[model samples]
Target: MPKWTAADVPNQDGRTAVITGANTGIGFEAAKVLAARGATVVLGVRDTAKGSAAAAQIVAASPGADVRVQRLDLTSLDSIRAAADAIRADFASIDLLINNAGVMYTPKQTTADGFELQFGTNHLGHFALTGLLLDMLLPVPDSRVVTISSVGHRMQAAIHFDDLNWEKSYSRVGAYGQSKLANLMFTYELQRRLSGKGKTIAVAAHPGGSRTDLMRNSPLAFRLAYKVIGRLITQAPSEGALPTLRAATDPNVLGGQYYGPSGLGESRGAPVLVKSSAQSHDVAIQRRLWTASEELTGVKFPV
Candidate 1:
C-alpha cells in the first residue's frame, strides 16, 4: 500500500467544510490543508480571536485561500447551536463536517449544560452539532460526517450509562476514554441510520499519539513522559490530522469504517483503515447512546 499524506488529499475545490476546534493542533492542520486545496473552510472555535488568527495564517500560507472563522464552544449548547445556524445560513449544502474538537484527562468538571466535561464536549456536543446541521449534508452528494475518536477508545473505554456524568466517582483517564468510545459508537449508529441513503456517510478517525496541547490535562507522570520520551515518539500535528482528512474525503471509504496510523502499535505513521474497540461496535450500546444523546441535547437528526 502507498503511504498516505496530506499530499494525497484529493482536490477539495467547490467543497464547503466546517471544522470544530480549528484554531489549533489537529483541527488547524486539517483546515489549513483543506483550504489550500480550495475548500471554503470555516474554523469553528470557542475563541473568535484565535480562530481569526488561524484563518489569517492559513490564508497567508495559501494565498487566495477561502477561509473564515465562527464561534463554537462545544462545552455550551447555545454556542454549538449558534455556530451551526450561522454555517447553515452561509452554506446550504455542506460537504464535510469534522467533529474534531475535544478535551482530554482533565480535573473533574461539568460543561455549561451540567454534563461531565469530557463526555459533554467530546461526544454530546458534537452529537448535538451534527444533529442540528445534518440537514445541510443529507442532500449533498458524497457528504460525510467525520467524528474524531482516539486510541484511548481502546484504553479504559466504556460507556457508563448508570453515571454518564461520572458524578458518583471520577477518574480523569477513564472519563476521557468513555468520551472517545462514545464517539465511535455514535458514528456506527449514525451510519446505520444513513444506510441506503447513498449520498451521506458517517465515518471516524483517531490521531495516533500526536504532540498537541490536548495532553495538557494529563497527570504529572504522563505529562513528564510526553515531555521526554513521548515527544521523541509521537507524530506531528500534520501527521495526526491524516486519519481525519482521509476519513473526511477518501472516495473509497465506507460509512462505519475507521482510520488511524499505519505504523507499529498504530502510534505514528501514514493514515490507513483501522479498527476500533469491539465495545465500540456494540449495536445496543450505540442505539442507547444515540437515543440518550437526542434526549440530553434536545437535537434530532433529519435522518
Candidate 2:
C-alpha cells in the first residue's frame, strides 16, 4: 500500500473522461493532467467560451492531447440531458465521469429547476448526470464515477429529508455542507449497488482547502475571511487536484474509497486514503438519500 501521487497515474491512452467545471480550479488541473496522459478529456462547463479557452490551454500544454469542450450547466436538467446526448452521439464509450463541479458558500438562491442553489448544483445536478449516463458507463469495463465532496460536510447537520430544499430555514454554510455530505453518500451507495458487478467503480475525493474561484461568489464576509486567512490554510488549485487525479487514475484504488489531502486537518499534502465522517458511512441514510435523489431527479440508476 504505497501512498499515491500523480506519478502513479498510468498512461490513459484510448480512455475518455468527462470532467465538470474543467474551465477552472481543481477541475482544470485534473483535466490537464489526464489529457496529457493521453486520455480524451471533455470539459463539461456552462460557459462555452471559458470551456474552449480551457481546452485550448490543455492542448497547448500537451501537444496532440485529445480534448474538447461541451456545454453542461449542472443547475439545469435540460443542460445535463443535452450534454449526455451529445457525448453519447460522439463517443462510443466513456471511461470516467468526474462530478467535480461545485459551488461554495453563497447567498440563498435556486437552480433553474427550482431546488436550492447549493444542493441543486452541487449534489442533485451531478446525481442526475451520473444516473442519465449510467447506460454508457455500465458497458465500459473498469469505468469509474468520481464525486468530489468536502470536509465542511462534517460541520453541518445531516440531510434534512423533510426539507431538502431548505424551505423551512436556510443557511448558506449549512446548505453547502449538506450538499457535500450528499456527494459522499451518493458515492458510497453507488459503489454498494455496483459491487460485484466488476464493470464500474464509484469513488469520492475532496480538495481540502484549495484556493480556487469556487469561493468567488461567496458573501462579503466569507470572501474577506478567505482573503485574510486562505493563505494560512488553502493550497493551490493544482495541489488541490491531486486527490481527484489519484481517484481517477490509481489502479490500486478500491471502489467506495475516499481520497483527500493528507496534511494537518486534511488541508494540504499528497493525496492519501482518507476517512469520511461516521454519518457519511450510514447505509440506511445513504439508501434513503439514494431513493430521494432518484425520485427528485426522475432518473433511476440503470443498475
Candidate 3:
C-alpha cells in the first residue's frame, strides 16, 4: 500500500477552492498544492494584506496560478457574510469549501458576536459560512465541503449544551475540546443532510500534531514543553496539510469519512483514513448541535 502525499493530488483544473485561514500553516500548504494542480484558489483570511501576501506567495511558487484573496474574519458574522457574498459574486459555483481556519487555547475571550472565541471561530463561524455558500455547491456535481478538525477533539471533549459559552467557568483546554468535537459532529450531521441532495459530500480531516503558529496562544508552560519535545513528535505544516488535501481531492473519499496521520498516536506521518472518538458519532447529539448552531448563528442550511 502506498502512502498519500501532496503529489497524489489530482489535476484540479477549473476547480475553485475557498480555504479559510489560508495565509499560513496547513491551509497555505493545501492552497499551494491545489493551485499548482490548476485550481483557482481563494485564500479567505481575516487580514486582506496578509491574504494578498499569501496569494502572491502561491502565485510566485506556481507561476500563472489563478489565486485570489477574500477577507474572512471568522470571529464576526458580518465578515463571514461579506466573504460569502464576495465569493458567490465572483464564482457561480464552488467545488470546495475547506473550513481550515481556527483558534487554539487562548485566555478566555469572546467573539464579535459575543460567543466564546474558540467555539465561535472554529465551529459556528464555519457553520454559517458553509450554510451561506452550500447553494452554489449543490448545483455542482462532486463538490465537497472539507472541514479541518483536530486530535484535541477527543481530549476530554463534549458539546456543553448547558454552558456552551462556558460562562460558568473556563478551562482553555475544555473549551478547545468542545469546539473541535463540534467540528466532527458538524461534519457527520452535514453529511446526513447532504445525502440524496447531490454529489456534494461533507468530509473532515486533521493535521495530526503539526508545528505551526496555531500554538501561539498556548500557555507558557505548555509552550515551553512543546519547545523542548515538539520536534520529536510534530511534523511540518506541509506534511500536516496532506490529510486535508487527500480529503478534498481524493475521488475515493466517502462522505463522513475522516483522515489523519498514520503514525504512532496519529501525531505525525502520511495521511490515511482514521477513526474519531465514539462520541463524535452520536447522531442525536449531532442533530442537537446542528439545531443549536442554527439558533446561535441564525444561519440555516438550504439542504
Candidate 4:
C-alpha cells in the first residue's frame, strides 16, 4: 500500500473538531491542517491566550479557517468540566475529539487533583474529556475519537495497580510510560465498546520522535544530546502530525488501529499502521484502567 500523508486526509467540510493542547507542536500542526481542510477546529488549550494566537495563526494562513479557543487545563478536573460544558453549549454535535495534549518527563509532581502530573494529564485527563464529549460524536457519521500515545509506552511501562498514582515510588520515565500505555489501552477498550454501534471510532497514534516542545521537560542531559542530534534523527512537527491526521481523517482506518512513523525504528517518516506493546493489548488491564479512571474522575462513558 502507498504511504499515508496529510494529503490523504479527506475533506472535513462541515465537521467540528476539538483538539487539546493545540497551541503548539504536533497538536498545533494537526489543528492547522484540519482547519485548512475546512473543519471548524476548536483549540482546547490550557492557555486561552496561546490558543487564540494559534487560531489566529491558522486563520492567517488558511484565510477562512474557522478556529476557536477553549480554556482547558488538564491538570484540574474542574477545568476539564468547565471546558466540556462550554464546548457542549456552543456546539450541537462534534465530529472529532482529538486527545492530543500531553506532558513529558518532568520531575515528580502532582496535578491539582493530586495525581501524578504525567499520568493525570496524558491519560486520565483525556479519558475524562473523551467520556464527557463522546455523546456528541456518537450520533455523527464517521465521527472519531483520536488519542495520542507515544513510543515511550514501550519503555518501562506497566500499570502499577498497587500505586497507580506512583505514590510508593516515582520514576518520571516509568510514569510517562504507564500513561502512554494507558492511552493505547483506552483506545482499544473504547473501540470494543463502540463496535457495532454508531459511526464513532477510537484510534491512537504517535509522533515517533518528532521534533516538538513536548520534550522540554526531559532531563538536561537528554535535552542537550537531542539538541546536537535531534535534527539528524527527528522529523518536523508537521511530519509528526501526519500519523494523527491520518488516524483522524483516513476513511480506511478502523477503530482500535494505531499509526506512527514508517521509517527506521518507526521514528521519522510518513505515517502508517503501527503496532503497540503487547501489554497495551491486555483487555483485563484495559477494563481495570477504565473503571479506575471513572472512579477517579467521576466521569462515565455513555457507551
Candidate 5:
C-alpha cells in the first residue's frame, strides 16, 4: 500500500483530540492540522504561555479552529493528575490522545517523581495520563491512542531490567533510546490489553528523524552537532507529524500497527506502515515494564 499523508486523514468534524507537547515542533504541527480539519484540539503542554501562543498561532492560521491550551508537565505526577482532572471535568470524551511529548539526550536528571528524566516524561508520564483518562477514552467509539516512538529505539541494547532507572550507570543517548523503545513496548501492550477487553481503539505510529526543538534540550555538544549535521538528515517538523496524524485519523489503521517515514533509513517521506524490532514485541518485557510503570506512577490501568 502507498504511504499516507496528512491529506489522507478523514474529516474530523466533531472529534476531540488531546496532543501532548502541542506547544511546538511536530506536536504543534499535528495539532494545527487536526484543528484545521475541524477537530477540537486541546494542547497539552508544559508551559502555559507557550501553549497559549501556539493555540493562538493555530487559530490565526486556521480561522474557526477549535484550539485550546492546557498546562501539562509530563515530568510531574501531580501536574499530570491535575491536567487529567481538568480534562475530565470539561470534556465528555476524547477521541484521540497523542503521546507526543518527550525528552532527548540530556545530563542525568530526575523527574519530580524521581524517575530518570527521559523514561519518566517520555513513557511513564504518558502511561499514567492514558490510564487516568481511560474512562473518557472508553466511551468514544473508535477512539485511538497514538504513542510516538522513534527510529532511535533500535539502538536500545536491552530492557535494563536491573537498572531501569539508570541508578547504577547512565548514558544520555542510551537512556533516550531505551525510553523510545519503552514507548513501542507500551503501545503494543496497550493494544493487547485493550483488545482483550474488546476495545476497538487502535494504537500506533512513530516519527522518523525530524528537526525539532526536542534537540534544544540536548547537551551543548549534541545540540551543535544536530544544528550542523541535522540539516542534512532530518525532515521538517511538519513532515514529521504526518505519521502521527495518519495513525490517529486513518480509518484503515489497526491496533498495534506501527507507522513511520518511507524514505531511506526511515528518515523522511510520507507515513507508511513500518516494522519494529523483535525486542519490541517481547511480551514478558512489556509486562514487566507495565508493572514497573504502575509502581512508579501510582496509576494503574483499570483493565
Candidate 6:
C-alpha cells in the first residue's frame, strides 16, 4: 500500500479554487499542490504583496501553473464584500471554496465590525464568504466548501451567545476555542442545508498539530509550552494540508464529514476520516449559531 503524500493529489484540471490565507503555511501548500495538478488557484490573503509573491512562487515551481492572488482581509466586512464582489463578477461557477485562513491566540481585539477578532475572522469571515459565493457554486456540479477547524476547539469552547464579542470580559484562549468550535458547527449545519440542493456539500478539516506561522500568538493552558509542544508534536505545513486537500478533492467524501491526520490523537500523520468533538455534532446549537452568524454578517445563503 502506498502512503498519501502530496504526490497522491488527483489531477484538478479546469477547476477553480479560492483559498483564503494562501500566502503561507498550510494554505500555500494546498494551493501549490492543487495548482500543480492543473487547478486555477486563487490565493486570498490580506496582503496583496505577499499574495503576489506566493503566486510567483507557485508559478515558478510549476511553470505555467494558473495561480493568482486576491486581497482578502477577514477582519473587515468591507474587505470581505469587496473580495466576494470581485470573485462573483468574474467567475460564474466555482469548483471549490476553502476557508483555510484563521487567527489563533492573540490579545483581545475587535474586527472592523466590532466583533471579537478570532470569532469574526475564523468563523464569520468564512461564513459570510461562503454565503456570498454559494450561488456561484450551487449551480456548478459537485462544488464543495471546506472550512478549517482546530484541535484547540476542545478547549472550553462554546458560542458565548450573551457576549459573542466578549464585551464584558476577554480571554484570548477561550475566544479562540469558541471560534474553532464554530467552524465545525457551521460546516455541519451548512451541510444539512446544502443536502437538499445536491450540487454542493460542506466539509470540515483540522491541521491537528502543525508548525505554521498561524501559531505565533499561542499562549494558553497548552499541555506544554505552546511553541515547544508544537515543535515536538506538530508535522510540516505540507503534511498539515492533507486533511484540507482531501476534504476538498476526495471523490468519496460525504457532506458533513471531517478529515484529520491519522497519528495518535490526530496530531500528525496521513490524512483520513476523523470524528469531530461531540459538541460539534449538536443540531440545536448549530442552528442558533447559523442564525446569529447570518444576522451578524448580513449575508444569507441561497440554499
State each model's C-alpha RMSD to the native.
Answer: 0.9, 1.3, 0.7, 0.9, 1.5, 1.5
Pairs clashing in candidate 6? none
Residue pair clashes in candidate 2 = none
Provide the global lDDT of candidate 6 against the true structure. Answer: 0.91
The local distance difference test score of model 4 is 0.94
The candidate, 1 or 6, that scores higher on lDDT is 1
Clashes of each: 0, 0, 0, 0, 0, 0
lDDT values for all models: 0.93, 0.92, 0.95, 0.94, 0.89, 0.91
| Candidate 2 lDDT over residue span 1-303, tens digit each | 566667778899999999999999999999999998999999999999999999999999999999999999999999998998999899988999999999988788999989999999999999999998877878787899999999988977589999999999988889999999999999999999999765899999999999898888777887899889888889999899999999988888899999999989999888999999999999999999999988888888877
Which digits, one per residue and each the tens of the lDDT, describe model 5 over residues 56-95? 9999999989998899999999999999999989899899
- The CA lDDT at 140 in model 5 is 77
Better of 1 and 3 by TM-score: 3
Candidate 5 lDDT score relative to the true structure: 0.89
**lDDT leader:** 3
Residue by residue across 251-289, what tens digits does model 1's lDDT show? 999999999998888889999999888899899999999
**lDDT at residue 236 of model 5 (Cα atoms):** 92
Q: Which of candidates 1 and 5 is the stronger one according to lDDT?
A: 1
User: In model 5, which regions exceed 4 Å deviation?
Assistant: 1-3, 196-198, 217-228
lDDT value, residue 93 of candidate 1: 87
Total clashes in model 4, counting residue pairs 3 or more apart in sequence or in different chains? 0
Whole-model alpha-carbon lDDT for candidate 3 = 0.95
